[model samples]
Target: MIDSDILCDLILANKHKCKGGEVADYIPGLKNANRESFGVCLIDSNREVHCAGDYEEKFTIQSISKPLVLMLAILDNGEDFVFSKIGMEPTGDAFNSIQKLETSNLRKPFNPMINAGAIAVSSMISGASAEEKFNRVLDFIRKISENPTLDYDEEIYLGEKETGNRNRSMAYFMKNDGVIEGDVEEALDVYFRQCSIRVSAQDLARIGLFLANNGVTSSGERVVSEHTTRIVKSLMVTCGMYDGSGEFAVRVGIPAKSGVGGGILSLVPGRMGIGVYGPALDPKGNSIGGYAILEDLSKILSLSIF
Candidate 1:
């Protein structure tokens, strides 16, 4: 087992040097975050957890929740049905950009990890109302985290709603293409609600553990299909980090997701899951400190899947 103390120390030592990556500013609430904030939490295969920095603090999961939602959509609607609304290819476009919709004839959201795809994926959940859909997403997240307390942050949701024009625009496009069903406004509402779900490092690490153990927690409860989880993990490895995914896979070599809220949920299947938070971001909207720590950990511990 990797020494928890050493991993935590490496994070702290590197924390100061990772100060000035891009901070998410377009969102009013996110703009106020402290760039110096940092945290890390690691959950081993046996479910033992280690923590460091601001690991105890909670933050919005943001895009990190996309895969979980995608899993729900897949389980609820089946792979063929969900895949119809999302492609496997990387968009190489900005996550919130509507350019793909305007230009591509395929009309699937390109991939489930992106904002556009996530909105479409969320729309596909088996619920009649936005609130019901929101509850299902929360349920899925809670099951994965094995934490009944996991929940949405309405403050963040409302703020995201106020500033999510890009998402709204994409949802509208998806609806028009007959890709996303139901009302666009309602779908966007549910989608934003999930992205704003609050998660501490422990919560995130547990969720990663769920993924690491093939959608089953250490307690032997199955939260999602092994097939669904495998497919989700495959997508995470290929595209979870958005445009930086390829480089990340080459370097960090873990199935992971990054979020604008300075959170990352990463995992090594059958071994461990880790969560990190650092408000400072890189050009890709991933946490600068979080990404660095995972990169360092992956290399130093020889944990890369590749």
Candidate 2:
């Protein structure tokens, strides 16, 4: 096992060096975050947490919610039905880019982690009302975090709503393809709401623990099937970092996710779940410091399954 103290020191030591990177200023609400802020937490399969720096600080889940939402859609509808609406390939384009939509005759988006694909996944999550879908999404995060206080950041949600014209456009485009049957506005509402779910590094690590442990909660509770967990983790490894997915897989060598808010959640199956926060981002919209931290730990601890 990797010593908790070693990982703690690694994060603390490297944080100051990464402060010069850009934060996620594109999202209006994320612009207010401390660009120098950094945190890391490691959770075991038993849900035990070891953390350093600003691990208790709340931040939006951001794109990290994409995989779990995709998982939920599978639970709501079978995988075959879900993939028929969204392709599983990783694109080299930017997350919000519309190039693929325009250049290709393909009807659906490439994958769920991208903006267009997320909108498609948003429609598949079973629920009649926006509130119902939002609640179910929150409930799943809550169960994984084991934190009842987990709630949406309303300010973030509103900011995303105000600036989510592109997302709305994406939903509408998907709707035109018969990919989304319900109201476009309602689906976008759920997407933004899920993106706004607030969680701390500790909470995020706990959630990661479930994915690391094959859909079983730390307490041995089965939240999803083993097969479902496998599918979810595969997507995380292949498509979690927008256009940088392939590079992240080669560099980090673990199932991981990057959020626009400068967070990365990573896991080593049956070994450890990690949550990291560094508001300074790389060109790919991932936290520069967070990825470095995880890569170093993966090497030092030999945690890479590959």
Candidate 2 residue lDDT tens string, 89-170: 8888888877687577777898888988887888887887999988998888888777878899899999899999888887
Over 4 Å off in model 2, which ranges?
none
User: Each candidate's lDDT (Cα)?
Assistant: 0.86, 0.84
| CA lDDT, candidate 2, residue 126 | 83
Candidates' TM-scores?
0.97, 0.97
Predictions: Cα RMSD each: 1.2, 1.2
* Best-matching candidate per lDDT: 1
Sum up the clashes in candidate 2. 0
What TM-score quantifies how close candidate 2 is to the native fold? 0.97
What's the C-alpha lDDT at position 162 in model 1?
A: 96
